[model samples]
Target: MISFVIKKGTNSNEMRENNSSLITANLLDWYKKEGRDLPWRETSDPYKIWISEIILQQTRVAQGREYYFRFIEKFPDLESLAMAEEDEVLKLWQGLGYYTRARNLHAAAKAVMDRFNGIFPSTYSDIITLRGVGEYTAAAIASIAFNEPHAVVDGNVFRVISRLFGITLSIHSSEGKKTIKKIARSLLYTEEPGIYNQAVMDFGALICTPTQPKCVECVLQDWCTAFAENRVGELPINDRKIALRNRYFHYFHILQNNSTFLQKRNGSDIWKNLFEFPLIETPLPNDFSQLVKTDFFGELFGGITLFSVDHKLAIKHRLTHQLIHTHFYQMIIPEEIPFNPPKNIFKIENEMLSDYPVSRLTHKYLETI
Candidate 1:
């Protein structure tokens, strides 16, 4: 039997340490039998592992699996990725939602070629220097690929650690992350940090899930403080709530002589570098009559004669922190060229629009026409 000496005002750090060891042992043992046979787990190739990690961010395992294979089939290796154009990379990642990840992945591939001689950096410090590689991603790659003893503290790890230890701190807070990182490092099985990290993540995703956890089958249930205290649902706290801002978009699909106009988004705003129709953003949703009265609309179609204007189609696209209500208007103009077009605006054959990488909203709109 384990016993603890109660010193007045002293913390129970020693007892906690002992519990962590037990948790680690039981978790790893359970993992050997129950861990999912994921494709990334079967290889130690840092490039493959890095691709899986990037694809898995904000993406479900089932969805990410298909994209992983598609990406691998397309790029094949770091060298292939580095030589490919950014547009080609984004085209492959068209349906992946987060285009920025694809962009950063392409950028990092080139960086690897230029800085590390086309080989993935092996150390934690070197891996973290890659574009869009944060602490969680760097730790994951370093530990899993290089067998480094860095403990990964991603969302899964955070949930598992918080519930097992009954930590009520907000996971979004800096102090909470630091505390969890400390606990994760202590519990990491240094002998096989790769397997251990994957095991913990699988345990959290399969057993200690966000909702409707399978507590009865969990290996660490006996020692899980939250389970014993009946606080499994309440332990892992995230008090930060995202306030979504609303934006209105009016997209004009101008067609003349079997050709349409599209412009590439160029700014720090969302969907940067993606192609879209001529856009008129307004403070609020406006009808065609009101939209045409605006000065921007006059400048856009000043010298052109419209043959017909189709009824507007509206789409509501939701992002993490923004709600976009887009109104798409189709306009057919005369074939004769009259005035100079807006900057970045160019004409493309209607059939060739599919060649461009467009936002999800634009893709959805294209499917209709």
Candidate 2:
């Protein structure tokens, strides 16, 4: 139960400035001894830092670290990523869940090569112009790689700042964002903005965590308003909640000889550009008898004689905003079936199916059967 007392007759601005200096000095001193030894911290390359920052978004450092190593190993540099095909890049990023990040990385890499003549953009303006590069990412790259004095306001920083300042405003609100950004900028160490930013982020991640924050061991505990006021759990509020929509997916795994049929998803829906078994989405989970009577079922497997049908496998996969309940129906047919499939549908040898990148739902089904 550490406490801080402000001296009498001190101006608000002076008090704030003193607190800011205290936070920066104490945080940097703690960071010098406590910061995690991340691979990205070893380099000043904007490309590597950009990759790490992108990978860390909505992902934990432990999980993102392996993915980072894998990505770097496959595509060693920006040129390698730029030269790679979209499918190849997505394949490498298959299990990472957010396919759009991989797509944007590929696009941004090409933009660097084509638009910037293979040179990584140095200025914040040019970096933010690239696809999927937002303010936080741009700030991280600029500060870490170029020593730009732009303050970063990520989830970690939000927690640390909100608690330290005893802010109860919803961080998702515009006013909250403005307040957090202003405070972060005011407290930023201009001489070593990169180290200061990383130090603050690390302090939040390792000390001021969302659950069971290490207040007892924290260097800023005495100055942390939330900690002193016993409101650590209540600060840094977020009112925005995700509304998940339920979707039913009926996947048809039709096999002929040693090959299985797969369809490439098109358009701007979930799992776009990814391969999956021929699908028939329904309003609800329908029985096989009801499914077989539909026009879609007849058109897909009309002439082919069904040797076997297994309707036991059902998978409930939860995405960021959509909860997909997928049921895989395996239909075995003869080798010389005369049924013609759609243009997007093609037969691939069962052994070679692992080569293509499939959605997590499809991957779950494949792993089971």
Candidate 3:
């Protein structure tokens, strides 16, 4: 029953053409001669590779490389990351916005320790089961680490394959994903899926770039429809992105006995594994003076030394569809939080503060203090 339906959707006509064979060979040859010497590219270690992949998710190679090196120096392996302090992890991830990836790496490290016994899951599905893993990440890790035959369909892959094959499917559409996945998988060389995958990704990033791609120099230009048709700008369709909603965050750093209370974000959202001071989110900016007078606000900073800093820094943190304007209040009080303070408010020491991972926005507050 499933076979008949599968036959209708599969694109076996392209599969039978055998066009990608020489293209794959030429591209791999080109990759061997021209590939960049990246740290992650040299290693087969799953942890290191996974870290690089996640860091590069919404970040560029150059910026992501700095974080990758910095992170590796701090936590060299899964055990170190698993045993590290939350603040320590966040601190390591400080400048690299998207604090959640750091937290997830930490959590996934712990998962590897507890469930996988400190060994990274080697299979495609097993790794995907990790806390923050998505399909694309799982595929990359699986293929790169264990040479699993799963096709990695990341942004680079979407762009390269969609344009090369002249597929007009929107890269963001459900059917488009299926179409690209089938094509990429069909062309994947089972013996060297990892190398092939990396080649295509690099080709897209450097040669098949989104703007003014160097098609004449591309080895795949013969098979690339966008090059032949001279429509390089039109292929690899993308759905119009919805506008990002503005979010205003105001944190009250209540100090009592030198420890500032913090709450870990729960559930599936941004900054999931990171620590933060008490947060009060609003649709728009509020009066800074009135913000400090809330019931819990008054108690947390009671006996205040008249040290209430407002809008100390403003940062625009962009997510997929949300743009958060985060601000921190650098206030100081006794070591003990007031009784009327909001629930879940804890205390942290100034020196010990560097041991936990706080959001990049939050890190700015710590740095200035």
Residues 111-206, candidate 1: write the lDDT tens digits.
999999998999999999999899988988999999999988888889988888888889998989989989999999999998898998889889
lDDT of 2 by residue, 144-168 (tens): 9998899988888888888888777
**In every candidate, how many clashes are there?**
0, 0, 20
Where in model 1 is the C-alpha error above 4 Å? 1-11, 303-305, 336-340
The most accurate candidate by lDDT is 1
lDDT per prediction?
0.88, 0.86, 0.78
TM-score of 1: 0.94
- For model 2, give the 10-residue run with minimal summed lDDT: 1-10
lDDT of 2 at 276: 90
lDDT ranking from best candidate downward: 1, 2, 3
Q: Give the TM-score of candidate 2.
A: 0.94
Off by over 4 Å in 2: 1-11, 303-305
TM-score of every prediction relative to native = 0.94, 0.94, 0.81
Q: In model 2, how large is the Cα lDDT of residue 111?
A: 91
